[model samples]
Each structure stands twice: as structure tokens, then as C-alpha cells.
Target: MAECDAEWELCKENIQPLRQGRSVSALHQALCQQQEGNHTALNQQKQSVHQTSRLYFTFESELRLYDGDDPLDVWVRCGLLG
Candidate 1:
């Protein structure tokens, strides 16, 4: 895990910066999900919210500096916004 963290730090500069920058943990989870062929939790939530028409905050939202802008932009850029 420490080795992965070190490598992540080294490659962070290559990731496109979002408004507040991407979450290292989120990126890690995304990579893990991809490797395991699992769907992302964020996408599941998005589907649920769409079907229920109910608002729910997400992990990404907690990192946002403002609420007006969509937090999915970062994921979209990373091709993780399923």
C-alpha cells in the first residue's frame, strides 16, 4: 500500500487537476474496481438518484468548494463517470 501511495504521488502531476483536485483514495478505488471488473459506487448512486428523483450527496460532493458546479466533471475527465 505504501509503495502504491508513493507511485500515486509521483504520478499525480499527470492527472488532470479538477477545481479542488482529485481524491487520491477515489482514484485508487477506481483503479481497483477497473482491475476487478466491478462497477463504481458513484455510478450506482447516480442511477439510483435518477430513478428515484431524490437528491443525495456523494463523497465527491463533500470535497466540493461550491455546490452549484457538478462534481462529476473530474470523473468525466478521468473516464470514470459511468
Candidate 2:
């Protein structure tokens, strides 16, 4: 969890530099570009999360259908769900 938080922080730090522009017009352009890029990225991320969740649910449902009981299945399922 700490590692995941650190990775997220690192990503934000990298994006922060691009968000803070060097000049007025440059800043405006950057801001506009950032907004557009963010919209695109957000859409992509949402789709990816949705697809991943669907896949996970499908896999879990299939596993349940097989009725193969395992203690670790829950953890594995949660990892995929995330």
C-alpha cells in the first residue's frame, strides 16, 4: 500500500512540472493542453477500470461455477478486482 501511494505521488510530481508553465502564453497553452489531455486520460482510465472490473467479475463467477474452494481465492479475486 505504501508502495502504491509512493508511485501515485511520483506520477503526480511528474505531471506537476508540466502543469506549471514557464511563461504566460506557454502557461495558457499548457493549461489548455493539460485540460484536454486530462479529459482523454480520464476517459481512458475509466474505461480501463471498467473493463478490468468486468474481467475480474467474470473470472470470479467462472471460478465459483467450477466450485473449486481455496482460501487464497478471495485474495486473488480482490487483487484482480482492484
Tell me the lDDT of candidate 2.
0.77
For model 2, residues 16-75, the per-residue Cα lDDT tens digits are 464656678877998999999999999999999999989788877766666556756755
Positional deviation of 20 in candidate 1, in angstroms?
1.8
Which residue runs does candidate 2 get wrong by more than 4 Å?
1-29, 67-82
RMSD of each: 21.9, 12.4
lDDT of each: 0.65, 0.77
- What is the clash count for each candidate, in the order shown? 0, 0
TM-score of each: 0.24, 0.45
How does model 2 score by TM-score?
A: 0.45
